[model samples]
Target: MKLYDFPLSGHAHRAHLFLSLIDVDFELVAVDLASGEHKKPPFLALNPFGQVPVLEDDGFIVPDSIAIMVYVAKKYGKTDWLPEDPQQAAQIQRWLSVAAGQIAYGPCAARLVTVFGADFNANEVIARAHSILTLIDAELANRDWLVTNRATIADIALYSYIVQAPEGNVDISFYHDVAKWLRQIEALPGFVPFPTSKAGLRAIS
Candidate 1:
């Protein structure tokens, strides 16, 4: 398996974390997004959307971070992570949607604005995204992971961007539950640190 990714992408990090948790061995191919490589012909052939975290598994190219997580869980991980019950699977899917939808638009977008200063309305984006975080904080008030009673793909999918919310200037100090959850994720066996650069915007294209 080969993972074509930008090291600093939170979306890519989700797949990275899941692969690590499952102890899957794969080659990492760095795509220099800084040079518009993703948009170039070679990379575009792998993913037309020009996104990172494209997983090449035995000639199958899987794009989208959330989809990669689902694939890994189904193909390699224990049933506990992916679950077998339809209701449980639905709930997990709901949280994954939260990660890809609300969390991506809110906290992730805020971080991009704060760190990269991308040309978006930061205030409005943050305002809308904060509500999602508040919902997560409340939902996680008494839980260890997002779905079921233990760690799942749901947790791995959401962990990277949500934990790094501070880097985007979103105050995470008030989200005590989230902070605790972050620590728990860090303590998990086979866990790896989120990749960082000396300058936060060093990887921006």
Candidate 2:
């Protein structure tokens, strides 16, 4: 298996972490976003969206971070990463939706502004980040994992940017439960981390 990746992308980090957690033997192929490599024909052939973190298993290609997680979990993760039960699946899907929507436009977008120089209202996105973080923190107050008794793709899908939200100036110090939840994920076997950036108010080396 091969993962077309970018070093600083949370989306890429999620896929990388999940693959490592599942003990998948895969090679990382860095896509040079600085050189427009992802926008070129070769990479575009793999994913027309021209995004990093595209996965290639044998001849099979998968794109988008969430899509890649779903595919990998279904094929390799069994019940741990994604449960087959209808109710559990629905619960996982709810959080997955938050990952794609709220999490995307919130902390992820805030970080994109500072880290990538994206043209977005930083204050607005940061506020959105806190709002969702508050909700997630509340939800985690009574649970260790997001969807099930064990960690799932829902947790993996949401882990990266939330942990890195401080890099976007979204203060995580106030969300004790969220912080604990992050530590729980970190304690899992084969865990990998998203790189912390110097952008925003908080800095991590």
Candidate 3:
């Protein structure tokens, strides 16, 4: 298995984190977003969307971060991380949508501005980050995990960007439940950290 990754990308990091958490042996292929490598023909063939975190396992190809996690969980028979129960599965999928939608526009976009110098309006995205985070904080108040009693892909899906939200100028300190949840994920066996950036350090400091 190989994962096309960008070190600074939360999208890629989420996929990377899941692969590690599942104790899989996979090679990491770094994509040079700085040089437009993902946009080039070679990488575009893997994912026309020109994104990192594309997974290639033997002859099969999987694109998108959450998709990669699903593929990996199903492939490895990790039912704990992705339950098969109808209601539980639906709940997990819902949070995945939140990850792709709310998390994307919120925390992810905010961090993009600081970490990669993306052109998003920082204030707007940061505010958006807080909105979703506030909801997530409320949801987490009565539960240890999002969709079920145990850790699932939903938690993995939401972990990356929210953990680093402070870097986006979206302070997470006030969200006590969210902060505790981050620590829980971090403490998981085989957990791999999303690499912190100097920009993130400066922002939080």
Per-model CA lDDT versus the true structure: 0.83, 0.91, 0.92
* lDDT (tens digit, per residue) of candidate 2 on 59-142: 999998999889988887468788989999999999989999999999999999989999989999999999999899989999
Stretches off by above 4 angstroms in model 2 are none
Candidate 1 residue spans exceeding 4 A from truth: 197-205
Positional deviation of 200 in candidate 3, in angstroms? 5.5
Candidate 1 C-alpha lDDT tens digits along 56-140: 9999999999998888788874788899899989999999988888888877887777666677677776776678878888989
Q: Which of the numbered candidates is closest to the native, going by highest lDDT?
A: 3
Worst 10 residues of 1 by lDDT: 196-205
- Return the TM-score for each candidate structure: 0.93, 0.97, 0.96
Give, for candidate 2, the lowest lDDT window spanning 10 residues. 196-205
Q: For model 1, state the Cα shift of residue 107 in Å.
A: 0.9
TM-score of 3: 0.96
